[model samples]
Target: MVDPAPAQTKLANEQVELNIPIQPLGAAISRYGNATGRDVLYDANLASGRLSSEVRGVFAPDEALNKLLVGTGLKAELITGKTFVLVPVPASQQARQTSSPEHLRYYGLIQAGITDALCDAQGAHPGRYRFTAKLWIAPDGAVVRSRRIGSTGTPRSDHEIDAALRRVQLNKAPPPGFQQPVIILIVPQGPGVTRGCDRP
Candidate 1:
């Protein structure tokens, strides 16, 4: 189970502008907590023994922790804003690494099969419209189901989106309690069609 960090509510979506150097794990995390004014829970022995990489940019609290903890064979699980637990990396990895829905939109894995599914709906399926879809993934990482959040202005495209989602697979299951479904906007290739999507 994930440990709860204190002040959990307060730190939600907290971003930090960090410029820490490569140093002992404890020192880096200590400086991080001090700078961000957040509480961190970790074992002194473990934190003191490992070395952390220098993180020199803006990042979320958890993302920063992940960056700092890289190659340490450790991971930080925020139980609450003020509390974080250090767990073996294998524990988290063995459970199927989950991809946060918000992060999936930028994933380069948008396969053509999905858009190709629109072959019969209308020749307009390609280069005709952009489709945004909500993907609900199961614990095993299979996109259990999906719904069209918005349409490509055509029912045919909407159905085609659903067909395409069924073919999409996730690398791992959704995290324990992912709040929102993943949204992917698919732009059919054509004159104005682009392969990638804009940041949400």
Candidate 2:
């Protein structure tokens, strides 16, 4: 079994500017990035103010984005005229790591296969879905398990993404010397769209 998703690293600042796609209406619509690209987040689609396409990785549903802006009076609507664009959210503390050489060895072994599964899974999705797949590795880098730390896509797609991740395998020994667990956060090749999918 995989370890649970790592908690967001305690942030030093309350709000950070995520590389989100905003419409000319000044409404954020999507987010991207994950471990596959070493969780590199990017900004896309914007001209002066109005948005160019439907945001792809805001994580939350359109209604949620609307709710978030309710107090602010800004509307969150999907743009139908343009193609959808994927963007990555801001990087968080939990997304990064500082490991020793031994840990690096295990990280390499586990991440190689894990990422491969991600590539295969992302390719299957119609929308470019990107998000962080957080993994727990031993001090030597052996993978314990993985979870979507962040995401952008449909709810069913998130489930599909989770299913795809479950197919990954880590059948190797961890690096020498370390016995503690290690964590690896992965970002898929596509954009993530899994925000505000909360339960009451």
Candidate 3:
């Protein structure tokens, strides 16, 4: 859980000009750090394959950061006036650490596999709904099983999401000590959501 009071107090009155484009979450965060002169620290896996909203106008750092993370199911916690870190929303937080290079690589592969599966079918395109999924992957990169924790507002959509996950197969095996039951949040497209998934 994050306490927004400190960030609110520190950045309530400071505004800066920003022109970050809708891009990968990690790059967008780097741009935010540069534009706001603040250090944003986070596990690289948290941003892997995630898209950020564009921040194109003058706004407080906190507000801009919030805008930048619109659909990614993440929030920033201020560590200091000059620093912040990204964390999963309270309900989605999992007991996993993804700091090692091998772990990060595995995470990226898993996410890419899931994204491809979700985007391949119109009924299950991730940009159309919101839900949380728990995945159990095999050593050879196949998604052995999956369980979704929320609905996509309809039984058909829920079935579609499950079907998509069933088709996921990563390019490599997970690293040692990588936790099981990976938790992933899927959300609809909005202000900062990544575009181009609809492209042919």
Candidate 4:
């Protein structure tokens, strides 16, 4: 008789808390997967040499993973209710998901604007903090919403990051009906040493 398929691990049913800090992309992912007993399939070539932001909060498996991969340019999708696959996103697709890059110069200009704003804020307030968020830009170069994926420990810092993102003025608005939310991570190079928002 044929062997029965292994029971799939359902992520939605799992509840777990995470306290992972900013580190190499591979290490963070591996650590989380191992701790939660979740099998995460990934390509070493793509995940290698990449850095990820920290994740510290109580959340379900899906929510925790979402926070972990915040600014890593990687996405996780649930397959078979238990399996998670990490995939790289292309620049072209980013536009389609968020909005058509007609006025915006794709991510180059968009990300630069965000980074500059974040750096400016970090310079003003010195501390160890990482803000991971998703921004929904309007068609008229307005920020419709800035949702913080995870806390930056202090409400004060979180407000600063939120304000910074809102302060960003895109040269061109995206195409209507496709205002795709973009991921932005504001973090420090070390402990209260260097602070900059990185796209990777």
Q: How does each model score on lDDT?
A: 0.58, 0.38, 0.72, 0.63
Which run of 10 residues does model 4 get worst, by summed lDDT? 1-10
Q: lDDT by residue for model 1 over 1-200, one digit each (tens)?
A: 21223232335577878888766667787777766655667767765545565578998877777766654556778776556778666655633333555334424343433444444333334455665766544434555556666667767656665676676655654333332245556665666656333221
lDDT tens readout by residue for model 2, 147-177: 7756565677677677766776667644332
Cα lDDT for residue 185, candidate 4: 60
Q: What does candidate 3's lDDT look like per residue over 149-191, in tens digits? A: 8898899888988888888877576664465557777767789
TM, every model = 0.40, 0.35, 0.49, 0.45
Q: What does candidate 4's lDDT look like per residue over 1-200, in tens digits?
A: 11113233445667877778666767887777765767677788767755555567777877778767654567887775666788876677654655545434555456666767766775324236666667655444565556767876777777877777777767675442232456666565585545444432
TM-score leader:
3
Runs of candidate 2 with Cα error greater than 4 angstroms are 1-98, 122-127, 137-144, 176-181, 188-200
> Could you say which candidate leads in lDDT?
3
- Whole-model lDDT, model 4: 0.63
